[model samples]
Each structure stands twice: as C-alpha cells, then as structure tokens.
Target: RFGMLETVSEFAGEQLAAHGELEMVRGQHARYFLALGEAAAPHLRVAGQTAWMDRLEAEHPNLRAALAWLLAAREGEEAVRLAGALWWFWYIRGYPSEGQQWLSRTLASGGSSIARAAALVGAGWFALDQGDVTPGLAALEEAVALQRAAGDRQGIATALNWLGNAYVHERQYARAEQIHTEVLALRRQLDDQPGIAASLANLAGC
Candidate 1:
C-alpha cells in the first residue's frame, strides 16, 4: 500500500509538470491568436455579418484565450483594441456578457482614448441588453462624442445605434426614432446597405 501511494504521488508530480508545460505552450498559442485577431479585425468592418459570424465562431475560443493572455501580460492597450474590434462578433454570437467583461477590464486598465471609446460602446451595448440602462446610455453618449471628435463616423454611428436601442428600451420612443433616423441617414451616406437596413429596422421598432 505504501509503495502504491508513493507511485501515485510520483504520477501526480508528472501530471503537474505536464500542466505547467501546457501553460507555456498556451502563451505561444496566444501570440498566434493576437496576430490573427489583428488581421481579422479590419475585415469585420465590411462584414455581411453572417459570413463573419461563422468565421468569428470558429475563432471565438482563441479570441478569449488571446484576451486572457494580453490582459495577464499587462498589454491592456492591445487587449482593448482586440476586444473592441470583436464587439460586433460578440454581439452577433450572443456572447455580449463576455464581450462586456473583456472591454470593461481593458478600459479600466487604461488604453488610448480611441480604444477606450470603442470599449465603452461595446460595454454599453451589453449593459443595455442586461438592463443596465442609465450607465449604458451614458457610456454610449460619451463614446459617440469621443468618436465624433476623432472623426470616426463609423464609430460614432456604432455608438449612436446602441444609444438608440437603449432609448427604445427606456420607452423614449421619440428619442430613439430621432437617433435611428440620423443613423439611417449616415448609413445611406456611407453606402452601407446592411447598416441602413439595421437603422431602418430600429427606427421601425420606435
């Protein structure tokens, strides 16, 4: 019995070492994901949404993994960038809570204002979905202003969309309609059919 116990303890030590080695490998794997995420983010900008949904689904695990690693490495800016980039994917994939949590942490970790604004919009969207209306609306409003100052029309439109939705939830139908109307006009100017359809649908909801 003593010898068997000794053998078991030795096996446990081996398993522990294997786990440690796997973690070392995970760090390398995470770096690969970081590169892939950066490359993929730009493409999502022109998403037909469904096609990118499948792509983002496949990469979802790696996205989470990369987020964990970057945050752990104190690369908050990079983490913010990646998380902000995936906000749309996370929403479409029904992983808004995960997206919200990632953005919140990265934003708090202190990145560039642009990144922070992006994260705020992401977080605001999920927060509104989760019934956190007031703060969510505030975040969305602030993000829209920030993005506007930076001349990021797309970003401003993104935050405005969220704010419009939040106003709908709050039963501020007139406000919601006005916001979505502006979004619709912006999308038309950008020749974004998908965005135009989205804004029109939201406007209809109001």
Candidate 2:
C-alpha cells in the first residue's frame, strides 16, 4: 500500500507540472485563459497561481496587454478583444469609459469601416443597457450599414439580431419579425446550423 501510494503521488506530481491548467496564451486565447484562471484560482495555491500568471505574461504579451486593460478598466483594441472574447465578458465587465475615448480616436483617425462598425455596435449595446433607445438604434443602424458596405455578412447578421431585439423591446413586432426572418434566411444560406438554432430561439422568444 505504501509503495502504491508513493507511485500515485509521483504520477500526480508529474501531472501537475505537465498540465497546470494555466498554459501560456495569447491573442484570442487570452480571454479563455483569464476565464480559466478566474475559475481555477480558488483551487490553486496563491503563490503558484501568481507564478503562473507571471510566466503567462512573460510568454504572451498580447494576453498580458488584454488582461491589463481589463484590470485597469481601460479600453482600446486590446481591451475590446478582452470584452469581445465572449458576450458574457462584456456583460460581466461592462464597457469602460476608455472605450469611448478610443472610439473617438479611431473615428477621427479614419479607421476602417470594420473598426468603426464594431465601435458603433459596442456603443449601441452600451446605450441599450442604459435605456437610451434612440442612440442605441442609431448606432446599431450605422453598424449594420457599415457591415453591409464592408461585405461582412456575418457581422451584418449579428447587428440585425440586435436591431431585431431592439425592435421587439419597442413593441414593434412586425419590424422585429422582418429582421428576424431576414437573419434566419441568411443563416440558412450560410449553412450555419448553430446560427439557425440561435436565430430560431431568438424569434421564438420574441
């Protein structure tokens, strides 16, 4: 029994070293890694976790930059990526005021339509959350138009889904239905089964 316990302990030690559940990460992996960090921190030793984060930062500057933005409540491409890592991140963290600063900067500097469209969408969502329908609708409208102009069908569809939700909130069922139907058609055309399911669920909820 003692020998078997020693063997098991040795194996567990190897597993911990080989797979920390805190691998070095960057780019899109940043958000997921941070999420895992948050989820697993409670179960990990504090000193070990700090060492892991330090190692992660050293290996992945982009991820570090993203995490710094979140920690500081700052906003820019780096911060936006962190927020957009998942919709839940945005909901949980909320848009930083610094985001508006960057948005204005991007617009003034003549950034690409895609960038502008994304900023506008972010603004629209922020406004919606604040109960300002006019600004929200206007921002989303611009985002949808820009997305179409940029030939970003997926982005356009996403904007359409939000716009449809806005319409439903305003009790404009007919308009919402039109937008939702259009989204469904586009999802089908794209052969996106998951998207179709989401759109269907959205429509059913409305």
Candidate 3:
C-alpha cells in the first residue's frame, strides 16, 4: 500500500515536471505531487536527498517543504509521523513567518490539543535555534501545559526533555534537573532505549 503510494506520487511528480501547470492537473495531480514529495522525503536524507526536496520546493514554491524538513526529519516511523504532522501544520502554507503563522492558527484552535502542543514544541525549538530565548521558553511552557491538560504521557515526556534543555540554556540548572528528572523517570517506566540514553547522558553531564 505504502509502496504503491510512493510510486504513484513519483510518477505524478515526473508528470508535473513535464508540465509546469499544476493547475492543469488540478485535484489529483496536485495531491499526488504533495504525496510524492512526502514519500520521497525519508529517502532524501541520504546523500542525494536535499536535491529532491529542493526540486520539490522550487517547483511548489507555494508550499512549505523546506521549513518542514528543517523542523523534523523523515527518519523512522514515529519520526516520520511526527514530521508529517509538522509538515501539515506549516507546509500547507509557505516559509518561516507564514509557516509559523499557520502553525499558530492551528494551535489557536481548541480541537486536537495534543497536535497543537506538538506544534508549540516545534516552535519553541525553532525560536531557540534562532537565539530567541523568550519566545522559545514561552512556547515550550505552553507545550508543557497543553500536554499536561491533554494527559499525553509521551508528549509530556518529550516536552519535558526540551524544557529541561531550555532551562539549561538559561543557566537554570536546578529547574533543568527537575524537568530532566521527570523525563528520566518516565523514560525508565516506558523502557524507551533512546530516551533512557539521552536522559542518562543529560544526568551525567549535570
């Protein structure tokens, strides 16, 4: 099923390349192009990956492919799903500011609070990467609150992990430790191998 979708998407992309008028193909062509871009995203992380993403973004400049790839990777099942959600949140629009605005719009809605929380988490990370601490902390805190309200254990743990890093960035070791401790405990309970390794590494450094 997935492979068929990939092939269809790829074929559609090839067709789109032959004809610049996405409007000509309208519904199915446009949809297939988007699907193919996403389908190829995971494989794009290998050496030749950026070229495809670049091609997709250049052809579909109206879409937010670049920003989506920036926010999350297309690696592994869970990561891909998370990246897809991020892509949908921002990629329905354009780059950076507009993409963030679209993300904010979805977060503004009350439905899918968990998804909104995840969006905020992505925002927080983006802000921090840009060297803006205030907005980053604000977004991370909101994500933590939303995850808590939604009772999403996994989301809560992930938010806490990032929150701990934000705290550490501000030289608030105590607060960082508190959040990290919570993540560590949850990771232990879940027996998440990678999470455990990250938590242990953080603790060791602390």
Candidate 4:
C-alpha cells in the first residue's frame, strides 16, 4: 500500500527527530524506512527514463532514508540488493561515480544475486567512465556470464549492450561490432523493438 504524501512527511519528521537524538521510537522509524524501501522498488524496476524515475527523483528524501537504514543496520546483502535496484538510475542519471562507491562497498561485503549482476554493471560503467577499462570490462564480463548461466535473456542483452560500449572505450571496435551485432540478432529474435533500435544505434557508432 502506498503511503499518503502527508503520512510520509509526518514520518520523515519523526525520523529526522530520531536522527537528531531528540526522540526515538523503538520500531516506528525503522518500520517506516523498511516500508519505504519496498515501496521504492517498483519505481526502479523499469531501469530507464520513465515516469517512475521522475517519481523517484521526487522521493529523494524518503528514498535516501530507506537506503541509509539498510546500510546502517548492517543488513548484509539486503543493503546490496536495495542499492542495486538503483543501477539504472545511476547509469541513466550520470551518478556512476557514486554508484561505484556504493556498489564497491556492497561487493566487498561478499554479496551475490541477480542483484549482483546489477552491482557489477554499475561498477563496470562507473569504472569505465573513470577510464579504468580493464576492471570495467572484467566486471561486465562477469555480469554477462552470470546472466547467461541464469538464462536471463533480457539481463544478458542489457549486460552485453553495455559490454559493447565498454569495448568501444577500449578501442576494440571489432569486439564491439561483434557484440552489437549479436545483440541485434537477439533483439530481433526477442522482438524487442526498442532494443533493436538501440542495438542499431550502437552498431552505427561502430
């Protein structure tokens, strides 16, 4: 159930107070953040520019609290999972540097999942943007490998799409061309019109 806007504001006030050490309820604020985290995930599932992303941008305060609570509570892989949900947001919105920081910390915690693929992809792009192509490619390769083993078609395509870009950064146009061509085939097979368009654009850059 979505919390009313007014309810979220009230809860935020309470949480801010708790953080200020003015007052702290045993479970109220914690529960509020927990719920907020769950609530935020549906908004992130699309992983690109969308109305949901606009909503996420609007909920920065509450979203930050939910994410902060997960990390501060030492929630293990849950923290990783929570942060990984923002991979698209980070990549699309140009927060790769911050994404790398959070994901590196998460990966250092020995987290693993389908979410792990998201972390790797985020780290890969962040590293690539920083011009660390080797580690970037390595992370992306692992991400693609994971998606393949999991038989996740969409995930594989997503990883490979970026992996192709990583290759471009390395001046490996042959590899990038091949990867994009492969992506094109997959997109055609999947009848992913948008993906096919994207693949065409990627290939055009090659």
Please report, in order, the local distance difference test score of every candidate based on alpha carbons. Answer: 0.79, 0.61, 0.62, 0.74
On TM-score, who's better, 1 or 3?
1
- Segments of candidate 2 deviating more than 4 angstroms: 1-88, 95-109
Estimate, for each residue in 139-192, the C-alpha lDDT of model 4 and write its tens digit.
Answer: 999989988988888888988998998898788999999999988988898999
Point out the worst 10-residue segment of candidate 1 by lDDT. Answer: 1-10
Please give the TM-score that candidate 3 achieves against the real structure: 0.57
Q: List model 3 lDDT by residue over 1-106, tens digit each.
A: 1123768867877888788844344434334444654665445435675666565555553334432332333212322233334443334234556545545544
lDDT of 1 at 69: 78
Q: How close is candidate 2 to the true structure, as a TM-score?
A: 0.56
Q: Give the poorly placed runs of model 1, Cα more than 4 Å off.
A: 1-31, 38-51
In model 1, state the lDDT of residue 82.
80
| For model 4, the run of ten residues with the poorest summed lDDT | 21-30
**What tens digits encode model 2's per-residue C-alpha lDDT throughout 73-134?**
33344344333332222333343454444444434444456656766766676667768889
**lDDT computed for candidate 2:** 0.61
TM-score of every model versus the real structure: 0.72, 0.56, 0.57, 0.73
